[model samples]
Target: MKQKDLIAVFDNDRDLVKAIGTLKENNIPVKDVWTPFPVHDVLKMLGRESRLPYFSVAAGVGAVIVTFAFLYYTAVIDYPIRYGGKPYFAFPSFVVIIFLLTILLTFISTVIVFQVRTGLFPGKEAEVPVTGTTDDKFVISVGSKEGLADEIITEAQVILSANGAVEITEQER
Candidate 1:
């Protein structure tokens, strides 16, 4: 799907929130939001559900389990090295290795999952519709559907301006 639309920029979080509230009050549809650092309660203000933390937790747990299982299988079944008269299944001695491996694998998997989910990594270029939105500003972007988009942009701009936004820019993408 292609996003063809206009985006309205704001200077700060308060202005962004006010703009979003105004849009909601006016029953205007907003397609997306962009911000510099994450603003507290922004998702709730915009009626969005957070998913990244949940996904990251799931990936970390999966990584830990897989790493532990692989190490156990390899040490007890594949290699079965009995060093210094230690038992093949010496669980206590394996704790340190297992914990270390679990952390390592979890970190690696978390990074990989984040990169894949966000479409970022080597040989991948992210499509940023508004670059300034992530620097010192926020953006309210709406896709072109009908004349509704212009109305939304106009109302959003008014709200943002009233809420103390220092600058506003509109661009068709």
Candidate 2:
């Protein structure tokens, strides 16, 4: 379903961040933000955080444990080899392969988890809220048509404009 949103565009990151801060202070709920480069403060202001890193860490740890367990089983139980007076359970030799596999699995799991969480896949249609958002523009989108009162929307637009929004418009998102 399409929903109407009030979008404020800014030419610089400062204006965008300032507008977000002001809107937040006014108790206005911002739907989303878009920018060519990430603005670290904006994420904090919006109370948004990503769990991808935690997932990556878990994947890396699991990979290491599974790889080490498999190596131990194969070397000691499945096929015990006593050659050159070397120990059957070689720990040092497994380090390199374990490290490599952990890295590989972590990378793959992070990508897969991000894609799944974001609902992104190959050949998916792009949803661009405004032009130049992926280039030099920063956009702050406020969902307006559904739950927000018209008075609040108007107040939000005024706040955005006062805080240096270059342009503000309403569109169905």
> Residues 1-173, candidate 2, lDDT per residue (tens digit)?
55667989999999898899899888998999999998889988888878788888899999999889988898899999977788998788889989998899889889999999999999998777887998999999987446577788899989999989989998764
CA lDDT of each prediction against the hidden true structure? 0.71, 0.88
Question: Cα RMSD (Å) between model 2 and the true structure?
Answer: 2.0
On lDDT, the candidate that comes out on top is 2
Model 1, CA-based lDDT: 0.71
TM-score of 2: 0.93
Model 1 alpha-carbon miss at residue 149, Å: 5.2
Q: What lDDT would candidate 2 get against the real structure? A: 0.88
Clashes of each: 0, 0
Q: Which candidate number has the best TM-score?
A: 2
